[model samples]
Target: MRKVILSGMLCCALTATFTIDAVAANSALVSPDRRISVALFIDAHDQAQYQISHDRQPVLLASGLGLALSDRQFLNNIRSIKPSDITEINEHYQLYSGKQSQVDYSANQQQFVLTNDKMQQLEITFRVSNDGVAFRYRALEDKRIDKQSPKPVSVVEEYTRFNLPQQSRAWLQPIAEAQTGWEHTNPSYEEHYQMDIPVDQPSTSPAGWVFPALFKIGNKTDNTWMAITEAGVTANDHASRLQARSPKGEYAIGLPMAAEVFTGKALLSHDTLPLQTPWRVIAIGSLATIADSTLGTDLAEPSAMDTRFIKPGIASWSWGLLKDDATVYSVQQQFIDHAADMHWQYTLIDADWDQKIGDDKLKQLVDYAAGKNVGIWVWYNSSGAWNTTKYSPKSRLLTAETRQQEFAKLHNLGVKGVKIDFFAGDGQSMMAYYHDILNDAAKYELLVNFHGTTLPRGLSRTYPNLLSAEAVKGFEMITFFQEAADKEASHSAMLPFTRNLFDPMDFTPTTFNDIPNIKRKTTNAFELALPILFVSGIQHIVETPAGMKTVPTFVKSVMQQLPTHWDESRFIAGYPSKLAVFARRAGDTWFVAGINGEAEAKTITLDLSFLQTMGGNIEMIVSDGERGFQTHKVVLSAKTEIKLQGNDGFIIRITPKS
Candidate 1:
């Protein structure tokens, strides 16, 4: 074991790990690969601050760190600072969801102990990994004080900051004001992103910005891409967002809104002694590294329950296209048959199933689907005083008893999962409510999908039963509004790098057929590419059976064989909100997919040498203008040129040579 101790004097260097016993004002913890470093120090004003750099290039400037408790300020007026020995951590974990099935995690960790003038002790721990860094804090009780019965302590505010460089650019989604949007169901993390804006720009939403926030620092030639988010958020903690005001490019953490709590629950977070906050993760590197990094899940708590009932597959959802009328028994039966015909594992019966389809008919439909080896999923309104959404099956899941009763009934009806929608914002109470629902659902062996909800924030790893969450402004928005459709290309392109980086996003991707009363902007090829491009545990596809009949046979075959759970994923090419290209593998087959988000046709040349080294046969399926597909066999080479039509996409499937 190696240690770097910081006592009272400032020290900065790029050296290998060695034991140093000296009084230092600052301590630098370098990554295992030595390419990333985090500096933790107490400044001249006696305030705790930190900095991050990649390859000696500044990624985040000196940022303040501390929090205010109801009793007093925690990190200010630091009396003494002591550092612990550096511990090397190397481990491997397996997950059934997200971009990869198995992950190898390596990091170097050190703890900083600080005591304020009030004799309050706070421990801040930093873990530096090759791809990025993560830090968290624990408020401890001082042994000198007389021990008494512990009482709840409120977290007044956190002063953590992420100060970007002046020239840095950002792509962030402004969180909606609580109780503002449709039926007071605002701040669902569904707002559109402000693409490639300056880091100093204030957010349009007075509430703040949502995570994971993407940024590009340094000059264009020497740019370092980064994303900021939090993980391992348990019910003991409240979820947070970026504060709206960023004075001098310094972004602070903001707690949830007053109305963001569950009805009759606390808005602020309260906990007893030894309070541990969630890990603040900053993924820093090239765009590829940012896309491929699993720091979010890497810092999260492992799965708590069995995953035998967790199955990853696609679902045929008619509500995205057919609306409320599609909830009828006949239409649902058609979708079940459609799923069976396409070899999909599930068919989703959306909102209003209780009144429209009724219990008797829904049971028959479930039995019918089961006979064909297909499962059924239903929807519910997270109804209470939280939102005024008039959807049916409401008020059935506001309490644990009622929620479990509903889940038990659904399990008896052969329902595989439940899509709970229209939740309140990210208050501590609502965060606990999310965990409650997942826990109750898991008891009855049911999968969970949250809509109109907060970001998963690595919950899929914590609870394997949680397959996906609809935090993005999904395809349902595109079907209802023309403006949303117009911005579809760019918004979809941004998700792979930002929203969908680690979480399983239920974007309800792909609709090759034209939507009613809305002009479809993305080409069929772009829509075709989505199934492979987007990663979701239970991908609820929006295309109808009639729409499927219009595509080429090869395209249909590719859709049928798409894998929801991937063995490995790599970023091949492209930029944020403009173009995205990715290669994902399942077993021995590889699926290379890309989309051009610009209005003009874009040409992309991919380096297929990595895939070629494995010796495989390739088939390229690309767009033929707006509504058709062009399929052909291609030879893998070092450089392969691919021309994508405006608002178009392509997918290249590689199989091991027989």
Candidate 2:
């Protein structure tokens, strides 16, 4: 029979006892052969619905928490559920039916266990080590529901709900505020708007799916209980509303409880509990590195994967993207010819080299690039159908499988890397897709450069092949967009504090002497200093081949000498969006770049204390003032102090004089 239970007992001062009376909800229902038990209790007196009841009988407030259940439906045709499956466990811990009883708690503090006459069992745990408490519950071995699916699988669904203490209004309010913030800033704007339900009248509100809300209890002054469903389930209907019983004797329905579930066998299935109350789980480090690393590091000490996979180089497109294929090929050859002269390791062939995916055209370019002792990196689209009417349909590697194969083919062709583009940050699904791409590319030993994508997040640590991500509003726009030049100074200063915290950023440094607009600032010398200023594994010396040939002697000298790897880094001065100074080390040499956003000059002294520890005579390469971004390169002797002007910058590379 379907029975509802109510139990309670009061402790003198520190402890409380709870006894539940099993009341039949439906007498005709038979108890399942195997059942899982889950329960929650509210102890705080401040909550509006601090306690729960059945048929006017007060249920036991075993702990300061509550329980609720959601009915999950299983779809027939789905295959393996990868990490991308968010529909079931949006952000809450989901318990899948399994024989394992070992519970793994996300945040466990206190523990409670109860079993009823029908073999129904419940386990509840709370963690309160930090400022807040986390409650988790698991109901096991419920009657299995049978469903006919195209694939063979067992389906089990249970009635899930939380048991809360009486008088829980104050504790519930902050939960409402946190939920509001979560919904407001949710990545899926439409989903957030649709999921918003009126707390008092959820029935009349528009029913649309949104992420589940966290259940809360207790007042801020004493303690607060917080609980969130693991990721997967969506809140779509009024069926998920939060029900509350008032302190005096009133019952009201609140907003729906947020919930998530997991369907695959790989998901762990145990109800977890903690020995204490209030616990904190923090994932720290650079957000960019986390974004880039498919396999995220522990919250602390996040770093890029080993640099052994990185083959430092210069690319052609970054130096110059030409309309004429022959000119581009000739320029590439010339760059290769001077590779030893400039200390560059690689040359890239941008888009349009391949007439088709398996065409001999790419093969020819690969052969030529290899003969020059330079590595070749080709470009490809993230996803797009090639148009034969406009270009060559045979050239497209459209599907994921096809792209994977093409990457392998490129690797076989001795292409060192591939540049991928046009990945708009769609949602969690797209994020998963990108992660898969990076993993697959790893198998082929292909270095990856992501263009037109979101900011990096140290994914390079997990996949060192992921060389750089281009999310900056950078120099490319300067030639066509007038606003680009105006914003360049400020944007450069802002990135180090914001984006660079994660991983290598592909800013495509050193665009000098090629500014189309005279009113704007751009020059060869400015470009020469950029490699030392920007921290990217793949440093691009972007300029026309003709421009490179025409570049001033001093500017060329600087470009040829800049180093890509660094041993140390320091932030010397300035605001995020104004002016800034940074010094990075590569062995005994140190490279410093200071940028000024305004048009006014400012003087600053170098803190060579770091160098003093190393004890060395510093040889300097200083490019400051308008000359910093000018085509004509100028250098000054080592000095204790340096002065720079607005909309200007400085790049200094110092090595110990032997």
Candidate 3:
């Protein structure tokens, strides 16, 4: 049996509070007495310390039994404690190598320092505010540690293999193999992995696992962690999960929220926290829809927080993969046609647009697109030579002064936005360059879409016109490559909990047809649902006019009707690897999307209780059928029960009926 413990003060404070039953094991009550009885669970062993406190009040609860990794001296001291010395349960939480570590603590340290004899030592300072805490981790090379280093630090590549249960193999087969490694080299060593999880049981909530890995800073190695917080489906509830990936060296002091949420993963590090480093926070609300209504206004831009550079608008190349002049003209025409048909507010032209942007051919295309009630956007390669080849000196707009002058010229030509690309990732000098681009772009009133860059850091709040950025592996690669698809679905599911926590992502959506050679299991309906599922401010429904014609009428209708903004949002249900459901409200209409990562049929139902108070019938548009990719042909009035197929999903648009 799971043990529940309440401190004396907490019990006293909650004497006559309203009693709310645990609807499920994870559910808890926020009592009027200012006490919250969260269903806490932790797996640990030996001398490790785990405690939960509310508003500074300590609560000693039962912790899980497991081995603890700490300083060698500390472990040696605690080894003598018998199993009886610690509370033990019949069923102990098992610890798996590479699985997430369990550690939770709260501190009020003004400055934190981290170092290992083998690596560099860094320092960090924290500032607490009403909203939350803010801090930076910095990396410095220790001459002593550097001299003793074993090898010049390089990334290690690992491939994961898992034998799935026969029932779960169908969806698991595609992505059974993945290559993992860290891509960013910064304040610390970071690693990336691709893996899949299978869900085959029925329960109110699904079992979850935390994944751990080792990161080497100088000569010292620290462990990083990520967890699939929730999985599986439950009746009348949506599925969802939360995941965080950060350096293990700062796990104890770095990750506090990982413990606040009942389910999630963490990396444990015994060393001190690093100083002056910029960490990335991404929180996506839905798997298919990237926009989070609560993100920009309430979270991203808090008045008291430090301001970072911001860029706005969607990337043109994401919507139209134009490699040359002709493709650019063709895509410009398509954008014009689609913009008018879909009431799209802005269109972006990606890189290489200026190769022949000054010629009569290009000018005609721009004029034609503008005439069709569409705005044109051009792309530029940051710091690349723009005056050579098809993009001649005549079309070149170099230097800050020239850039501003050209912005005026483009504005005269009715250009609406600009997609900047090919930013070389170097040191702080490059960082300063990126910031300058954003500042200059703002001067010209040109919305920006940053490609091949760092993650967003709440710049959108300062510049509401800034739309989205592409830091994550997005849908464009799906057009020609199958290499990333297996992890794509799972990665999409993970974003809501990790990457999206920071700001909006420009993960261009709704590519209905697979490009020439790529392997694809997704259908037109699935494509249409992405705009409603992914939390992106500016959405891209990329398809050739001919390809668009081939899409099913219902799918096209749904894509045309999808909205980019929402009034409210909720995570109905899901785990990071199995399934995820998100419901968003845009005025009277509520749009909900359910995406599955596992193989096999699953049932999902949305609670209509929120709608009951409205006291009216609701119109529903649901897509689910024998073919997971096929659109649901029938339009029905609300009844509640809905079924979803494995590796498939549905989009529902509900409006209150008079």
CA displacement after TM-score superposition, residue 574 of candidate 3 (Å): 1.2
Q: Which of candidates 2 and 3 is the stronger one according to TM-score? A: 3
Which structure among the candidates has the greatest lDDT?
1
Ten contiguous residues with the weakest lDDT in model 3: 94-103
Candidate rank order under lDDT: 1, 2, 3
Q: What value does the lDDT take at residue 224 in candidate 3? A: 13
| Candidate 3 lDDT by residue in tens digits, 523-599 | 44455556666766666656655666665666666555565465566666665556666777766777667676665
lDDT of 2 by residue, 17-130 (tens): 433323222210111211111223222231111122222233223322223323222121111111110011111111110001111222213334433333333443323221
Q: Give the C-alpha miss distance for residue 76 in model 1, angstroms.
A: 2.6
Q: Candidate 3: list runs displaced more than 4 Å.
A: 1-326, 359-367, 383-399, 613-639, 656-658
Q: Which pairs, if any, clash in model 1?
A: 7-24, 8-24, 8-25, 9-24, 9-25
Q: lDDT scores for all predictions? A: 0.86, 0.42, 0.39
